[model samples]
Target chain A: MQFERAVSVEHVQKNYGKFRAVDDLTFEVHGGEIFAMLGPNGSGKTTTIRMILDILKPDTGQIRVLGGPLTEATKMRIGYLPEERGLYRNVPVLDVMIYLGRLKGLSGDEARQRSLALLQQLELDEFSRKKVSELSKGMQQKVQFAVTVLHQPDLIIIDEPFSGLDPVNTLVIKRLLTDLRSRGCAIIMSTHQMQQVEEMADRLLMISNGQQKLYGSVQDIREQFALHAIIVEGQGDWGKLPGVVSVEPAANGNGHGADRALLRLDDQTAPGDVLAAIAASGDMHVRRFEEAVPGLNDIFIQVAEGAH
Target chain B: MKHLWIVARREYLTNLRRPSFLFAAFGVPLFMVGLMFLVTTLISNAEGDLDSLGNIGYVDRAGVIAAADAPFVPYADEAGAQQALQDGTIGAYFVLPADYVDSGEVTITSREGAPDSLKEAIDHLLLANLTPQAGDDALASRLEDPVTLTVRALDRGRDLEEDAAIGVIMLPVVFAVVFFISAQTTSSYLMSSVVEEKTNRMIEILITSVTPLELLFGKIVGLGVLGLTQLSIWLIAGALLLQSGQGVPALSGIELPLDLIVISLVYFLLAYLLFAAVMAGIGAVSNSEQESRQLAGVFTFVSVFPFFFFTTFLLNPNSPISVALTLFPLTAPLTSIIRLSLGALPVWQFVASLLLLGLTAALVIWMSARVFRWSLLLYGKRPTPRELWRVIRGTPMTAVGTAAQE
Candidate 1:
C-alpha cells in the first residue's frame, strides 16, 4: 500500500522574507483517491502546491513524488494545473497540447493523437486549430484541463480545477476527474470551493494561515462538524417549531416539488422531539427528516472563522 | 539531456519561422552580396576598358620624340594642333613646352573627353622618346607596373601585402561586430522568451516539467544555435563572395584570413554563451521585457567595450592593457582576436585567455541558473541584490531542486 503513494510531503515549510507561506505542511495523496486541499486566499495552498511540484523549494523537510524524489520520468507522470493560468496564446490549441505532451515524453504522433482525442472528448474539437487567444476564458480553461490530462499522468495536481466554468462545463470536468480517480490516478486538487470537495473528494486537508486546520475523510469531517439541527423537507414555519432556534432557507426547494428548511435545535431539544411535533401538526406534511450532517461549506466556514 | 534538446529544437524551430529572424539570418547577407556584385561589376568594367586611344595629335616643342607611333599625327606648332583638333583629324592633342624636361608638364585640349588609356598612351610615348631603354618591351612593362610591396614579419612568419594589409587589420573588428550583433539579437530573443514565460505565468507550468538548469541551458543553446545559424549564412555568403571574386580583377589577391575567422568563431561561441546566460538571468529577475532589456544593456555595453579600443589593441597587442582586456572574458572575444590578427599572441597567453573565457562562461551560467531558480516564480516585486546573493550562496532548501544531484 505504501507503494500506492503518489505524493508524500513531510513537514514542508516555505518562507519569503519573514512571512512563512507554507508551514510544516505534511500530507500524502495516494493513487485511486481524490485529495482536496482547502484554503482561503493567502492561506498557503498555492505555495504548498508549488513546493510539491518542485517549483519553489521548501525551507526545510522533504517531499517525495511517485515514491521518491522527482526525476524527469517522475515529472512526466505528474500533470499540474497552476493557479496563475496561461498557455502560449499565439499557438493553436492542439499544437499547445501536443507541445506540452511532448515535454512530458510523449511522441509527436502519440501527443497528436492524444490531443485530438482529448479535444473531441472535451467538445473542443472544432477549436483545435484555433489559437488559444481566440477561445473564451471558460473554453481556454477547459483546454488547459485537457492539456493537464492528455498525458494520462498517474498524479494530477490541479489548482482551482473547476473555477471559471458554468455548471455544465464544471460538471463535465468533474466527471472527467472522477473517472481518472476511479482508474487509480491520484488527484490532488487545491480549491476554495467546499461544496465541490464535499461532492467529489474522498479525503481532504484544510489549511488556514499556513497551518493544517483539518485532515480527514470528507464524511468524517462533515460528521465531526455535524450541527444540532435537522433538515425538514416539505416543511412549514420551522422558526415557530418547539425545539427550533432558527430556520434557514436552502436549495433544491420549490422547483423540485418540495420546500427545504434547516431546523436549528437548541440545547436539551432532542431531534426525536422535533419529529414528534412535526407528526402532531397536520398543517405541514413531513416528507424527509434527518439529523443535519454539516456540509463542507459549513465546516470550512466554522474552521476558518475559528482560526481567525 | 533529451529535455534540453526538445526545448532547444522547439526554440530553434519556433524562432526559425519568425520573419524577423529569417530577415536577419538571410536578408542581410543577400543585401551585402548584391552590393558586392554591383561594386565588383563597376570595378572590373572600369579596369577591363576601352578598345583604343584612337588617333592622336601632338605638338612636340621639346623635340624629344624622334618619330611618331601609329596614329600619332604630330603638328609643328600649337596653332596647327588646334586646327587638326577642330577638323577632328586627331581625337586629342598634347602640347609639350620646350622646357618639358624641367617641368614635365603637358597641356592637352580636345572635344572628346580623355580616358585613362589616353593618359597612359601619352605617358608611354613620352617615356619611349626620353628614356634610353624605350625599345625594350620588358623594361617598359616593368616601368608600367612599378611597385607591389610585401612585408614579411620576421617574428610571426606571415606576409602582409601592401593592398591587403588594411583588410587584415579590420577583419577582426568586423568579425567582432558581426558576431556581437548576432549575439545581441539572438540573446535578446532569449531574454524576451524568459520574461514572456514568466509574465505570461507559463513558467510555473514549465518549471514543474523541467529543472531550472535544464530550462536555462536549453534556452541558451536554442537561441545560441539561432545566432550560429545566422553566422553560418553569413559565412556561406562570404565564401560565395570569395568564389565570385575569382574572376573580378579588383578582388584577386585578397585572401580570406582563415586564422582570424576560425579564432573569432571560437571566441564568439564562448562569449555568446556567457552573454546569453547573463541575459537569461536578467530576464528571470525582471518582471517585464522592458525592464529586462534595461538590465541587459549593462552587460552588453561591457561585452562590446573592446570594440571601442580596437586601435589601441591593434597598435599594441602585447601591451599590458591589451593583455588585461584579452584575459578578461567580457572583452576577451574581440581583444584576443585582435591580438591574434596582429600576430602578437604568445601561445601561453592564448591558452590562458581561452581557459579564463571558458571558466567565466561556466561560472556565469551556473550563477544564472541559480538566479533562474530563485526568481522564476517571483513576481510583482524584484529581489534585492542581497537577496539574490543569498540565493546564489544557496539557502538550505530541502529536496526537489538542483540541490539534489542529477
Candidate 2:
C-alpha cells in the first residue's frame, strides 16, 4: 500500500526578532520511513518540530500534516516526545501514560489497555503502579516513550529519544522504531547522535545555524561525500601502480589477517581499471576490495565545518 | 472542548487526592470549632466562679432601700455591717449615703475586687425603692418605659429591622472575607500549577494535545471547582453547627441575604478569573516557582488591602475612597460586595463596576494566553519587563535562536 505524506514543510521561515531560527526550510517525511533531523544545540531543530506540532506557528510558511492542515483531529494522530522530558512526577506511571493517551484521543479503557500492554512490552509492568518520581531516569524515559506511542499515532516525532537510555534500552527503542516504521508509521527524530541516525534513518535533513546543510537519503549522502577511491586489504604496497594518485593505510582495525590500504585514483582512472591492475599484480594478494564510502559522522562533521 | 475537559478532570482529580486539600478542607473548620470550644469553656468557668460568691451585707443610712435583695443582707448601721464584714459573715458590705436618691452615691468595701453581679443586684434594689408611684394607668405605663427611639432611613423611606440592619452591616464583610479566601486559594493554585507545568516541561506535551487557552481555562475551572468544594464544606458545617445550637454566638441569629449571596458568588467568579489570569501570566513569565509566587504576592496584597479599611468602608460605602475601590478592577470584587451588602450601591454603579471587572478579566485572560504560549519553553531567566510588555501587546516572541540575542 502506498502511504501519503506524513509531514510536509514548505518554505518555512521562523525568526525571533533579528535572528532566524529556521530559514526557508523545506522537507517532507513520508509514511513508513524514519526521517532524522540532525542539528547541533540551538540549531532550530526543536523550533521546527514545534511548528510541525502547531505549538508554534511559522512566521512565513505552510506545514501540512497527514496531507492536510493540522486540525485537532490531525493532532490526535500525531505523537511528540519533547527534548525536555517530563511527566507528572507524583502520578503513577500507568496513570500518566493513560492520561496522555486519552489526551491523544484514546478511550479510557483503550488507553488503559494500551498503556498496560506497552508497559509489559517495555519490561516496566512491575513499576506500572509506582510514582514516576520513584522510577529511574531510564525507566521514566521509557514511560514517556510509551505515552508517545500509546495511542498508535500515524506520525511520531521524538527529540533526543536516546539521551538517557543505556545500550540495552537504546536497542529496545531502535527495535521499536523499526517495528513502528514497518507498521506504516512515519517517524521523525531529531538528534545529535549520527551513529543512531546512520543505523535507523532512511533519509535525513541536517541543519546548522538554523539553515539546511545537508539533506538526502543516508546512502546518497554518504555516497556524495565518498572519497572517490577503493579500499583494498591483504598486504598491498599499491603506491607503485599506474593511475594511483595516493595510497594510505586504512585506520579501521578489523583483524582479518590483512592490512587495509586506501587507494585514491587519478581523475582519468576508473574503479574497474584499478581492480584490473590490482588483479594483474601477481605479487599482491587482495582479500577484499570496495569503494570507500564516508560514514554519517564524518559527513556530518565535514558538512558542519564546511558550512561554518 | 473535549481536551479541556480531559485536562480539567485530571487536574481536579489529582488535586482533590492531595493530602493538602484534604487537610485544608476538613482541618480548618475543626480548628475553628476547637477554638470556639476553648473560649466558651473558659467564659463559662469564669461565670460559674462569679456565681459561687457568698451574699453581700449593706447599710442604708437614709433608708434608700426598704429591704435588701436575696444576695444582700441589710444591717442596722454601718458599724454593724463593718463588724459583719470583719467577721466574714458576708462577702462585702455597701454603705448608702444620707441623701442616696439625690446624690446617687454608694460605697462598697470588700477584701477582693468588686464583683459585677453583686454590684448590679444592689443597684437594682436601690432603683426599685427610689421609684415614684404612678397616679393613673397611663402614667404607670409611661413610668415603666421612659422613652423609645425608632430608626428610619431617609433615603429608602423605611424603618430598618434589627436583623436586616445587622445583615446589612455584616454581610459585606463576610462576603469580602469569603471572596478573598476562595479567590486567593484558587488563584494561587493556578499560578503554582502553571509554574510547575512550565518548569517540568509538561506544558510542551500538553500544548501539543490542546491549545494554551484550553489548558489555562481547564486549570482555572478545575481549581475553581476545588475552591467551591472547600467553601461548600465550610458553609454546610457552619449551618449544621448553627442548627445544633453550638455555632459562633455573633453569627448565630444573623440571616443570610440571598441577593448578597448571589452577588457575592458572581464577584467571586469574576475576581477569581481576573486574579487567576494575572497569576497565570506571572507564572508563565517566571522561571521559578519562587519568582511566580513573588509576583503573585503583589496582586494578593492588592486584593486583601481593602480589608484593612473594613470599618471605613462599612461606615460610608459612598465615600470617595470606598467608591474608588469599588470601581477599580482589582479592589472591586470585595469593595462592591461590601457596598452592595450595605444597601448603598446604586444600580448604575453596580453595572458599571461589573462591566469594568469583566472587561479587565477578559483582557487579562487574553494577555495570559499570549504570555503562556510564548514563554512555555523558556528557561534559566525570567522575561524582562520590555519582553513581557511586548508579549502582552501581542508581539510574537522571536523563535528560540533569536531569543538569545534579546
Candidate 3:
C-alpha cells in the first residue's frame, strides 16, 4: 500500500555558536508508520524535533509538516511530548490534560471528555483529580502521554516516551503506539531503547555528533550490517570445519551437546555450503542451524563507534 | 489571537483559583478593617480616660484672672496647689506668677502631659475673666482667635475649599500606593509564572501550540486582569465602607475626581505592561525562581524609584530631576500619575510622558517576545551578555543552525 508523507525535513542545520547541533539532516516520516530517531545524548535529536515542531526555526532548511510549513493551523494536527517530562505540578491532572487538549484546538467539552477517557484507558482515572505533583513519576509520564495524544493529532512526536515506565507500563505504551499507528497516525519517537525500536520502528535514522550514521528501513539496515555467519546447535568441532574461519560459543547456551557454536564463514564460503559440510561430516547431529542477523543494539554500538 | 485567548484564559483560571490569590484579594482588606477598629477603640478609650481626670488646681497669684466655671479649682498660693497635686485631689496644677501677664509664662506640675482639651478650657477661662467690664461675648471670642487667614488661589480666582485642599494633599500618596500595589502584584505574577514554566520545561510544549508573543501577552493580559479584579474589589469595598461611615476617618470626605480616576487606571495598565514585559524577559533568561527574582528586584526598584523622590516631585513638579524621571520610561508611569495627582502637571507634559511611556512599553514587549523565543529551549546555562544582545538585536545565534560537517 502507498503511504503519504506526514513530515519532510531537508538539509536542516542548527548551530549554537561554533558548535553545530544538527548538520544537513534530511528525513521523512510517512503516514501510518513508526519512525524512530536513534541517537545518543546531545546528538541534536531534540533540536531536530524542535525544528519540526517549529518551536525553533532551522537556520538553513525546510520542514514541511502535513504538506505545508508549520503554522498555527498545522500545529493543531501535531502532538509533541518533549523529553522534559512535566505538567503544571499544582494543577489537577485532568485539568492539565484538558488544558493541553484545548491548546491543540479541541473544544472544552471535547477536551474534558477525551481527557477523561484517556485517563481511564491508562488506568489513571483514580488520580485524575489529584495534583500532578501528587502522582508518581511513571504516572506523570502516562499523564504526559495522554495529553500528547488527547486531541487525536495526525502526527505524534514523543521524545523518550517510555523513560520512566515499568515493564508492564512499557508494554502498555508499546501497544498504544501500535494502536495509533494502525489508526493511520504517523509517529516519530526518539529514544535510547534499541530493543523497543527494534520491535516497533518500521524505519529509523541514527545520528551521532549531529551527522547521520545510518538511515533506512529497520530490516534493511539490520541486513546490511549483518555478519556473514550462521548459528548451529549440533555438537561438533565446528572451528575445524573447512569453511569455518572462527568459532565462538553462542551466548544463549543452547548447544545440543556440551557447546553451541557460531561459525564465522570465510570470504568465499556460503552458509548453505557450511550446512552441507556439517551434515556430511555426520560426526554431530544438527538440532538448529540459521543465519545470524545483527540486533539493533549491536548495530547501534557498531555505527556509533564507527562515527567516532 | 485565539491561541492567545486560550493561553490567557488558562493563566487566569489557574492563578485566580490559587489560595494565595484569594488570600490577597480578601484577607488584606479584612485585616485592615480589624486594624482600624482596634485603633479607633484605643483612641476613644484614651480620650475618655483623659476627660474623667479630676479637676486641675491653679494658683492665680496674678489676681488679674479668676477661675470661672472651668475644669480648674483656684488655690491662693503655689504651696497649696502643689499640696493638692501631691494629695491627688487635683490631676495637675498650674502656678501663675504675679508678673505672669507680662512674662507670658505659667509653670505646670503634673505626673503626665496635660490634655489638650484641658489646656484649651484654661485658656478660655483666662480670656473671659481678664477682659474689661465693657467687654461683650464677641470681644471674648475675638480674644480667643486674634486673627484668621483664608487662602485663595489666584489661578482659579476662588478660595480653595477645605476638602479640595485636603484632596490635593492626599492625592499623590493615594496614586502612589495604587500604582505600587497593582504593578508589584501583577509583575511578580508574570515573572514567577514564566520562571515556573521555564523551570518545568513546559515552555517547549506550550510554544509548540502558540507563539512566544502570544504566550507572553497572554500572561500579561491575564495577570493584568487579575490585578485589576483585586483592585476593583478593594475599591468597591472601601467605597461601601466610606458610605457607611465605617471607613478611615481621614478619607471620609475626600472626593475622587473622575479624570484622576481615569488617568490612574490608564497609568496602572501602562505601568503593569512595562514592568511585566521586563520581568518576563528576566524570567526567560533565568534558570530558576531565585535567579529570576533577583533580576526582578532591579526592575522593581527602578519602577518604585519615583516614590523615593516623592517629596521633591510633589514640591516642584517641574524640577529637572522630577521631569527627567517622569519622562524616563521605567519611572514614567508612576511619576506621571503622581504629577497629575498634584493637580499642577502641564497638559503637554502629561501627553508627552504618556506617549513616551506607551511607546517604551511596546518596545519592551516586542523585545521580551524575541528574547523569550530565542531562549526558551536554553537550559543549564544562562545566556551570556553578548547572546542576550544578539537576541535583543534580532541576531540569530550563529551556533544554532550550522550543519555538522562529517
Candidate 4:
C-alpha cells in the first residue's frame, strides 16, 4: 500500500491563529505520475506541500509519504522546492549546492562531483565559483532547483517552480521536469503557470481558499467543463444549422481563410448531428468538424469560479 | 549524530575560512604584540628622562616635611603655586593651607584638563605626610620604629610560578569572554541561518531529508566546535604572552588549585551544551534575525553579568555574594572555575555546587529540546516566552516532515 502511493496527505489541516492555511486537504500522489496542484497565490498549495515534507505539523489529520510514517528514513525518498527560492548568498554557488546535497547524506566529494555535473548540464558550470549573491535571479533559481534534486529523491514536490523565469528558462525547466517524470519519479508541482500544467501535468488537484475545487485527470476536467465549438467555412449561414446554440466569428486567416464561425451546440444535440446538419447545408464547406475540448485553463477558470 | 557532524563540519569550515575569524585568531595576537611593544617603548622613555614628569609644585606648611621626599617641587608660598597651576607653567599644585594643620586638609589645584595621574600622586603624598602627625611625640616615635612582621602562607606550594598563573587564569576569563561573545555571536548565526531558511521557505525542502531537531542540533554542535577551536588557539597565545612578559606583582603569591582545571572542563562542556540547546530552541521559534536577537537577550544578560561582578569575586571568593553567584546554575560554570583557579576550594561547597549545577544543566537540555521539537515548525511568527511553555506541555509534533535518514 505504501508503494502504491508515493505521498498521501489525508484530511491534513494547518491553522495559524484563526486562518486555516490548509483546511482538511486530502489527496494522494501516485508513485509515478506528475501530479500538479493548481491554484492562484495564497491558496494554500505551498502549505499542503510543506505538510507532506514534514516541515510543518497539521493541526489534525495524518500524512504518509512512501507508504509509512514520516521518519528520518522516509525523508530520503523525497525532494522539495520551496516557493521562495534562495541559497547561502555569500557562499559560492557550487559550495552551497554541494553543502545542501551533503545534508541529505551525500559525501562531500560525491556531492561536489554531482553538483559539478548538474551545473555543467544546466550550463551553469562557469558560474560555480561565483558567489550566489552575484548570480542573476533566474540563474540562482536554477541553481536552487539543482540543489533540490541533487540527492535524487524518488518523490519531488516543487512549489511555483517556473516562477520568475524567462520563456527559454521556463522551457528548459519544463523539459527537465518531463525528464524526471519519465524516470518514474512521482513528481508533484504547484504552479501558477497554467500553460505548464497543460503541457506536463498528467493529473491535477485544484484548490481555492483552502478547499478542493477540482481533482482529476486533465481529460476528465476538460470534459466536465465541455463546450461545443465547430469551424464552418461555406456560403451557407452558420445560424441556419438546427439546434445551434450560438455562432461566433473566429480567426479567418493563417491558412484557414475567409469565412470561419465557431458554432456552439444546444443541450439535446450530438456533435455528429451538428455535423450532419452542417452536411445537410450543401452550399457550405465544413473545414473543421470536431468537438472543442476545454483545456486545463478553461476548466481552471470555470471550476475555480464555480467554487466561489 | 552523523547529520549533526556534517552540519558542524560545514559551520567550522565556513567560519574558519572567513577572513573575520582569521583576523580574530592570528591578527589579534599580532595586534597584541604590537601594543605590548608600544607600552615597553613608553616605559623605557619615561625611565630615561626626568623632564617628562613636567613641572610640578607643592606648598607644605609642615616644617618637619622635607622637599626631597615630596613628589613635586616644594614652593615657599601659595602665591607662586597658584600662579604656576593656573598659567600651565606647572602641571598641578598641592596646597597645604594653614587650616590644614588643625584639620589635616590637602587640596590639588590644576589647570583645566591637567593629567589625572599627577593629581592622584599629589593626593597620595599629602595623605602619607599627614599619617605621621596623627599622634603626639611618643606615639609618633613608635610609628617610625613600629615592629614589622613578615607574612607567609602555611604552604608555599608553587610559589615561583604563582605570578604566571594569574595571567593563565586571566587567559581563561578573557577567553571565556571571547568565548561567550564568539560562541554567542556565531550561535546566533545558526539561529539567523534557521530563521532565514524558515522565512525563505527553504526549510520545507531541508526537513524532508533531515529532522528539524537534527538540523538544530547540528547547527549548535557545529558552532560550538568553532568556538572551542578559537578558544584553544587563544589559550596557547595567552600562555605564550605570560611566559615572555614582565611579572605582575599582584599575582606573585597566588596558585591555582589542581581541582580547578578538572572542574573547569567538566562545567564548561555541561554549560555549553545547556546554553546551545536553549539557543536552538530560540532559533527554532524565531522567524527573523531581529526576532532572534530579541529572543537571545536573556542569554546575553547571563553571560555578561559574570564580567560585571568579577572584581568582587577577586576580592573575596568566599564572600556570601560570590558563594551565592557561584552556586547559581547560570553563573556557576564561569564563576566557580575562576574561584577554583584562585585558591584551594572547600570540598563540600564545590561538590554541592557541582551537583546542583549538573542537575540544572540536564533539566535545561530537556526543556529546551522539548521547546525545539514543538516550535521549529511554527513559522511566520515568533513565539513569546509564555507561548513556549504551552508548546512544551502538549503541542503537536506530527506535521513537521517525512524525514528520510539517508
Residue A261 in candidate 1 has what lDDT?
Answer: 76
TM-score of every candidate relative to the true structure: 0.86, 0.87, 0.88, 0.78
Q: Model 4: runs farther than 4 Å from truth?
A: A1-4, A9-26, A40-44, A56-63, A209-211, A229-236, A250-260, A273-282, A285-290, B44-179, B246-262, B396-406
lDDT, candidate 2, equals: 0.80
lDDT of 2 by residue, A200-241 (tens): 999999998889888889999888988889888877679978
Give the TM-score of candidate 4 (chain A): 0.90
lDDT of 2 at B84: 85
- Chain B vs. true chain B: TM-score for each candidate? 0.83, 0.82, 0.82, 0.66
* CAPRI accuracy category, model 3: medium
Q: Candidate 2 chain A: worst 10 consecutive residues by lDDT?
A: A251-260
Task: State the TM-score for model 2.
Answer: 0.87
**Using alpha carbons, what is the TM-score of model 4?**
0.78
What is the alpha-carbon lDDT of model 3 when measured against the actual structure? 0.81
User: Over the stretch B132-179, how does candidate 3's per-residue lDDT look in tens digits?
Assistant: 843255788788877654444332232324444545566567656766
Write candidate 2's Cα lDDT for B1-406 as tens digits: 8988888888888888878778777887787677667776765665554456577888888876764446788898889988887888887888988887688888998867676766766655665565563124355444545664344433433233453444446656765776678788778888888988977878878878888788888898888888788778877665554455334444456555577777888888888889888998988888788988887888888877778777876566567888788889999898887666555676777888899999999998898888877787777677778878887787755543243222
Per-residue lDDT of B42-156 in model 1, one digit per residue for the tens? Answer: 7656554423335788988898887667778889898888888788777778988999999999987866567676688777777766768655556666677688777554445
Candidate models: Cα lDDT each: 0.81, 0.80, 0.81, 0.70
Tens digit per residue, CA lDDT, model 4, A152-246: 87888888898888999888888888888777789998887787888889899999888888888876887777676665665567787888888
DockQ of 2: 0.47
Please list the residue runs of candidate 2 whose C-alpha ends up more than 4 Å from where it truly belongs after superposition: A240-243, A252-258, A267-290, B54-63, B75-119, B122-172, B245-249, B380-406
